[model samples]
Target: MPHLQTVFAAVLLCGAAHAQNMIRGEYWIDQDLGFGANNSFALAQQPDVASIQLPISLNGFSPGVHTIGIRTIDASGHWSLTNFSTAVVTTEPEPPLLTRVEYFLDQDPGFGEGTEVWSGTGTDAPGIGSLPDVSALAPGSHTLFVRTIDSAGHWSLTVHAPIVITAPDVASDIVRVEVFNLTTANDPGFGSAAALTVTEPQINLVEAALWSDDPLSIAQGNTLAVRSMDSNGKWSLTNFFSADVVHTNVADLFTQTGITTYPNPFSEGITVRSEDGQPLRVVLYDPQGKLVHDKVLNGETYIDLGQHASGTYTAFFWKELERIHRVQLVKH
Candidate 1:
């Protein structure tokens, strides 16, 4: 009975001491004798506890099995016995990339969102021919977006390809096409001075804008109206496109770009940079993953976002095929 009471007292004392000590984890690769705490705290609690998701650098470790250790160091400078866990390190597979593209008429009901017929379920692979059997599509014009999914289930961005399904002998379907200028001048005479005459009816699509070549040439207010003609020489309805011009007053720069943004919900412009001594190319994407801007930098660059609508954006810094850094940008 006396021995039992002594053991109980010792256990209680250890638990009380631990309540005041700061507990942390350390790691040792393979059979290394020395332990290091380069990693973040796995667990830390006093009266209250918090969880942090900060990225831990693991550059020093190679692909192999390693044992990780955790211990407690109290305020009185006493070290606790290290507890260990085993870990296996392996390389993560790279995402697959789209190589080739071909399209056919989609005959299946409720298939794709766009006008083109497509099947979403298929084998995603690298170097494998992804040509869909087009022998079933009807004669018409369509488009397809091709993407690849890596073995790790990471899907790559899509790329668009145009496809034309020609009829037995089709011609002379076009008539006269009309466009309207709704910005600086509201034109009724089929846009500008006159309407466009479709001498060759095979043209399925028409595109025009005030800044067709130079985007900067467009002013603060501008819009474009466009439509097409079919084989019966009958004109289709008109589609309108508008643009909101923006200000380009930005001048300050930065030094590094490991997740950095200023005025968080920023206006007018945003500054970006990275530690990469060489020039950096920053690619900006909207919330929908649509690319909005691409710029090259020499240490620092001021991106004019005054014209862009207020929203959250993602910025990725690239070094050739490798993505060096990624961060979020907010525009007010």
Candidate 2:
């Protein structure tokens, strides 16, 4: 390629004295041609502050970074310090075309050593390309470095981007099973229901007792929503089931079972008493007939109702299969 020529111009104060006229100036490029040993030029009118335009030729200079420096001689014939400017020279009319593209994950494997995605495309730009399988990589933050090679076999600077390989979801064992009554507005949502022991991955509700304080009742045709959580704390989608509803008349079943419940109208909590100090079960239901609370206690036990909304609730006292007494309680 033929050498490229460029003009370097600079406004210079001739040796710091504005009153002193600039008589002559000289400039040299690349190699310092040593003071007046290089080419010299005369200044017209010998102006004190000279706007000098130095024409430099890169006749034998190779295509790369080069510098040009210029200094002026005052009327007193004293040489001023040289002022330098740098530039890059290339023989190509335009930037080289991208011929190859390669990338490496996490660590850089050096230029031309990365996994090649494209080769000799002979284009100035390359669009999105396919990457190798990263399934073997561990989960966590990672980096991907990419670089390109030109038609001249010159590799461009490596460009890096962050690559995140998140940990895949692993199968987890079911830890707890819970149920909710979808038909009632008092449904405590998921995770709020009383947790049932999960002995296996699959659960059979028919064998599972629904006597907990959760709003789920053993009612037929009522949509019973069931969900299970795994050891990873992830909950499964609720599965709905409807079955036969059983009903027993409280007035007909009251048999003086020696179980007494007090404070029909109360706030916060209510107390259930087994007058005979015998063990008995108490089940409280919401206005929608969804079982809200169920527990077996000996003597007296207090149940918190303060968190419940202001409405009428029913409590059924039971001695095993026999229903002893029922009472309507109000919460403020």
Candidate 3:
């Protein structure tokens, strides 16, 4: 007598007691086959049990065409029907392509004064996708917006990058900050719709950052101005700025993995490393490629390049034989 085995929730069971009368089982091969139906000689006999193995062999069947089925007849002559199984072949389609990439930068109020700063399609280079080189933005906290247009004439969701531009050597404390909404001429005074006052001011007021989660209406722009105010109620010269009013989530701006640099317009060396604390072989090349710097660093390793001249330089982070990341460092 063959032993009994059970299958529940897709798991096989063993060592089950079985004492009952024998029951006959059958299998159907035809697509239209129903209970108490199927091809001839495709039947097996078994005892009354919740689980049983009834194997049968069929010959002279055509290749690439066949459906196997099973059914069991209990001691009461009750038929437990089975579902037909068929092979389904599927070919995965390719994803939509982003034909182009455009970016906008909200720069310092005195420079790059506009909603749009730079736009271009990214290169095919891997790891270094079509991300923009924002070395031109002034040292301070700024917003970068990027979006893509698919080849199907469709537009994907706009993504934003919140970056802080800073210089390492020129560290300063921020005293007070102000915001200006230039979306319309209704407010020409460049007066802040928002402001923050600090008792101690940093060396550079430009390092102060201001943002609003509630974006203004379309066709609206904003400017930020910061200055050190005296206790006697006197205000310093206001450095006005303009920016795009777009709703953005700060979290989405950063990736789960990659290298990050700080002090955008860095005066000294900048910190570089993987998002997840890992070692990276760093390299630096001046615009003309005449000056080069290299090192292996880890999480938050502050690389002081203050000795280098104040200009734009390219930094590369290599993992093994591949250059995992790259960025343009703006040294002030």
Candidate 4:
């Protein structure tokens, strides 16, 4: 008879000897034929040797049936025949999911390039779907989608949900202002309310401005003065009033004085100065406190204001030690 091949029989063996059995195993990718091997051994008295398992690298392995095998090595230095097993692995790529969706208006009224349009959702997997109505887009981009995790921990495929954003029209009555009648009128102040009849156009303009160079703030009981240019480029004050604060854009305050910004109402280039004569560090932020520029100034620093539209900005100056000064700068 053939030499006793006790591999399978050894796998079924019980008691302490079963635990002492040593198993040598190997696996191979069916197509590439790349192979890997590992070995494991248990105490002789342990029963049911089937509990031992081996790990294999499934990466880049094609989806199909693969063969695996294990053998026993006896204390006498004799190798048993291989007892083989097979399994099938599958590889499937899941598409990205649309987790969040939002809608908003754009600034610089009139629908066109640079006008407010729906922005796709934020995701790492893949592209977002196209929006439903292009006409409703304002004069800027709006966040259209958001990525979210599901309960099962698996992300769903991408889905494009419809968004309806109304664009503002060119009209003097786009926004309305009403001053509140306060009993304490002599308090050296006035409270007012601003309302938008044509929300699309008015909101679009504000949203555009907020999204552009700096983020905008909406706070309760705050005054807002809006100036808009229509599709025909006709300039008009759409709304000017003090209302129950809805949003407030806080100006960034920089305490560093080591550097100074020249030309208060700058048109072109503004000079940054340092008092210590050391390399000066400068940073620029919009009213919303977002960093637009960060750099170290060698000698004198020149910043181009032509690219930025007329607006107020915060300039922060610093050095190796600490923040020295922060001041407001205006670009026209």
Candidate 5:
């Protein structure tokens, strides 16, 4: 074996092609290196196909550019560098619409009560969808309004009807009363034993015309009860008073002179003296133009003002069409 020389050498290479072989449609590389030969390399190969497509299932996807890397392994167990690809996906939001409306009147008649008195539902009505119905409402007097709701569960607007309330009639001298005697038994002071009569001459009414032996004193205020029969034979109670009594003087039997109000600025009580035998009507008013009290006097009428708070009030005397007098009284 004169010329037997064992050559030992190794080769190292990088990049696209090194120690690789392309067989029948596939490429191959030998990774096994014998004693003196060791080689490692990267192979770059392109398939005849246009693109590598993979199925992806997603409910929602992001938009814009995307990158995909592809790699292949040769028979020699080597890998190629990663390649990049791109794609775009897009998505959009949905659109919006309308919901419900309601209507009604706040007053009893549901008609013309005031300006724009009617209120009700719907957004397109008027005044930012808050205007009450002024046209469809009744002509003379009524109340109305409306309300509306949107598709998003939001309320659109609320409308209100005009306010109208009638004031009570003040011209009628209707009053209520309770009667009491200031005298006691065995006093010889012309007390409860004396007969008592109460009457209203203008309205042709006789409230009480009898005598009670039981002495009663309404030093405290009392409520009087009076009833009248209408032309239809309907008996209705309409007036109330503090007390009732008979005329004491013979002169008072025919003239109203026996009935008179005393102590112009009376604080505790006021004496109503009536000399003429006729009934008299008394009307009392406070400074605020409110009727405080009213009554018909037929005898010595005593008004207890002790229950009234400190204030000035006006008292008016009336007998049918005639207004007797007006006096002012101060309370302390």
Candidate 6:
């Protein structure tokens, strides 16, 4: 006879169409005790299909070799085939522990050449108390590689972490700032936009109203773009805000703008006629104020709208940075 050993029995049972609930289960070791006659056990609950974990006794037999079988019975009195498994019991051995950890920056100094961060007798070395100085390294990106050796002298795969070094900041002067139009025909181009006078190296707020002799046409949707220049003559990217209605001089909208759009209630597409043959940007927005189409046109250009849903949309015509005309369009 042997001391009783607890074996974890994972039992799974499939129910037949005539049977839905698994009602009981049993297990036997080494020899057959016939169905429903082996060591029976009670399940916590009855389910249509059963998957459960229970403990089976491994006693009254030698530890050298043994076989265990499990089965279940359903409400319809159908017994599942035995799930047989073999067990081999033996004494356990001691496990290895972590003995050392080493790390290197940028380059691999090779095995023992890396600075040792930890050395002790333990299963784990949690944290590194001391780190190498990085002040001498140049300002840029670098990688730190780390590895560990176990008590059995086995080295793990090297792991690395990326690091970035930031340099000290230098003062830059604010020479000038400018404002311009992006879609208007009178775009002064980059450094050519109207400059705003400034005397400080850094500024938080800017107060100035920029105007053009020939401004963007009076429309609901219009923008004025502005940017700043450093003393090094580098111009910042344009920042735009909605333009307020200052004054209005009604020009010949059709003749002066030199643009025309045909097929008012268009089905498939529409045509834009540019009389002066200059490049113009056309943008269309759907009823919910979503932009549906946008393109730059030169001479006479045809825009196909066959893919858009049937709805009323607003179209804005722009010459360079200036918006010259805006009209409502219907697609049927």
- On TM-score, the leading prediction is 6
| Tens digit per residue, CA lDDT, model 3, 140-183 | 88887655565566655766778887855533454444544344
| Candidate 3 root-mean-square deviation in Å | 28.8
Residue 254 lDDT (model 2): 35
> Can you write out model 1's per-residue Cα lDDT over 1-332, one digit (the tens) per residue?
11111000011112223445445433343454543443435445442222222222345566665565444445445545554555555666443443322232333122122232322334443343556556666778776555444334454555667788786654556555555546756656533333554545554333322212212112212355666666565556776765433222122123233423455668788775555655555667766666677655666567887877778776555433222345566777
How high a TM-score does candidate 1 get? 0.24
Top-lDDT candidate index: 6
Give the per-residue lDDT digits (tens) of candidate 2, residues 17-109. Answer: 455667777777777878788778887645555456666667767888888777887776678878777766778576578888888898777
lDDT of each: 0.47, 0.68, 0.49, 0.44, 0.42, 0.69
TM-scores of the candidates are 0.24, 0.38, 0.27, 0.25, 0.24, 0.41
The CA-based lDDT of model 3 is what? 0.49
> Between candidates 3 and 5, which one is better according to TM-score?
3
TM match of model 5 to true structure: 0.24
Candidate 2: C-alpha lDDT: 0.68
Measured with C-alpha atoms, the lDDT of residue 54 in candidate 3 is: 41
lDDT of 6 by residue, 1-332 (tens): 34457778676655565635677888888888898889897755465655667776665556566888888787778887787777655444455688899988999988867888888988789778666667888999999888988888888899998988898765677677666545454667877766655645674312232222223233343556667777777766767765432221113435657677878788988888878897776677766777766666678989888888788877767663433466778889
Candidate 3 matches the true fold with a TM-score of 0.27
lDDT of 4 by residue, 83-131 (tens): 5566565655444443333332333222122322233444442433444
Better candidate number, 1 or 3, judged by TM-score? 3
Model 2 clash pairs are: 220-243, 220-244, 220-245
